[model samples]
Target: MKILVVDDDPNILELVSIQLNQAGYTVQKATNGFQAMELLEEELPDLAIVDVMMPGMDGYTLTRKIRAYADIPVLLLTAKGELEDKEKGFLAGSDDYVVKPFEPKELLYRINAILRRYDKAVDVFIQAGPLKINRQSYEVSVGKKVLLLPLKEFELLSVLASKVNTVFTRDMLIERIWGYDYEGDEQTLNVHIKRVRGKLENLTGEVTIATVRGVGYKLEVASI
Candidate 1:
C-alpha cells in the first residue's frame, strides 16, 4: 500500500514516513498541502496522513479537497486532542484520526483496521465458465488453477470484475482505479485492461471486456 504524509514539521514528516515505510508501505512526504496536491498529479496514495497544523492549506482543507472526488481514506495526525477538534476533522472528511505524539504502532493499527473494513472477501470465487476470480485475494483462476497477476493488472481487473456489465468509460476507469489525483494516462490503463483480457482467453464469454463503441469497456455479465 502507498501512504502520503503531509506535515510542515520536518521531524514529524521524516518520522512518519520512515515508520510507515518500515511497516511495509511505500511512503511519500510533502512539507505542505500545496506539495501534497502536486504529488497527487503523480498518483494518489492508498491513504493520507495529514497534520492539522501547517503553514498554508492546513490538513482540514486538504482533506476536503481530496474527498471532493476520491474515496481514498484520510487520517488526521494532529496535536490538538479536543473533542471539538476531532469533530471538525470529521467534518472536513477524514475516515480516521490519530493524535500527535502518538506511537507509530498506534497509527499502524488504525491503518490496518481501516484497510480491513475496505477489504473484500476474495474467498468468494466468481466464475463464468472456465474462468474464476477470487475477489478477496485478487487472484484470477482458470479452472482449478489461479494465475499470478501484477499489481496494476490486478487492480484493473478488480475494478472491472467488481462491476460486471457496467460500461465504464476510460476516464471513469482512470478515476476508479487510479483515483482523482492520478497523473497517469488513460491509455496505460487501457493497455492493462487488455492484458487482463489476454489472461481470460479460456473463458467462453465473448469479449468479457465489452467495448462500447466511442465510450469504453465493460466486463460482460453472465446470463442466468
Candidate 2:
C-alpha cells in the first residue's frame, strides 16, 4: 500500500515516512497541500496522512480537495485534539483523526481499520423492495434508474438495506459508518440520514427509511 504523508515540519514528515516505510508501505512525502495535490495528480496513493496545519492549504482544505476527485481514505495527523477540531476534520471528509505525537502502532492500526472498512466487498448485493444495492460496484438502482449517491449516503443505505426492518441505533450507525473514535455528534448522523431519506424517497416509494421513536432507524420494504 502507498501512503502520502504531508506535513510542513520536515522532521515530523520524515518521522511519519519512516514509520510507514517500516510498516511495508510506499511513502510519498509532500511539505504542503499544494505539493500534495500536485503529487496526487502524478499518481494517487492508497491512503493519505495529512497534517492539519500547513502554509497555503490546511489539512481540512486539502482533504476536501482530495474528496472532490479521489475516493481514497484520508487520515488527519495533527496536534489539534479538541472535539471541534476532530468534528471539522471529519466534516472535511477525513476517514480518521490522530493527534500529533501519536504512537506509531496506533497510527498503523487506525490506517488498517480505515482501509479495511473502505475496501470493496467481493460479492455482496442487497435487494430491498424496488432498490438494488451492489457493494462491489458502489451502485444503487431501482428498476432501470440508477442513483449516484455520496459515499456516506451509500454506506448508510447499504448497512440499512443489508437487514430490512432491522433497527440500528444512532450510536451503532455512527460507529459503523464513521470510525469508533469519531468525535462528531448525533447531528451529523441525523443530517446524513435525512439526506439519504430524501434521495430514497425520490428513487422509490416502496422502500423507506423508518425512524424508530427513541431507538434509531430501519429500512422497510413494502410487501409486493
Q: Please estimate how well model 1 matches the true structure, expressed as its whole-model Cα lDDT.
A: 0.75
Per-residue lDDT for 1-224 in model 2, tens only?
57899999999998888987765568899999999999999998889999999988999999999999798999998897899999999999999989988997778778767865765442277888889998878889998999988999998898788768877667557766886678989999899999999998899899999999777899999898
Per-residue accuracy of model 1 over 128-170 as CA lDDT, tens digit each: 4445677667677665667878877876676566546666567
The worst-scoring run of ten residues by lDDT in candidate 1 lies at 115-124
Error of 2 at 210 (Å): 49
TM-score of each: 0.58, 0.55
Q: Once superposed on the true structure, which residue ranges of model 2 sit more than 4 Å away at CA?
A: 120-224
TM-score of 2: 0.55
Q: Tell me the deviation in Å of residue 82 in model 2.
A: 0.8
Q: How accurate is candidate 2 locally (lDDT)?
A: 0.86
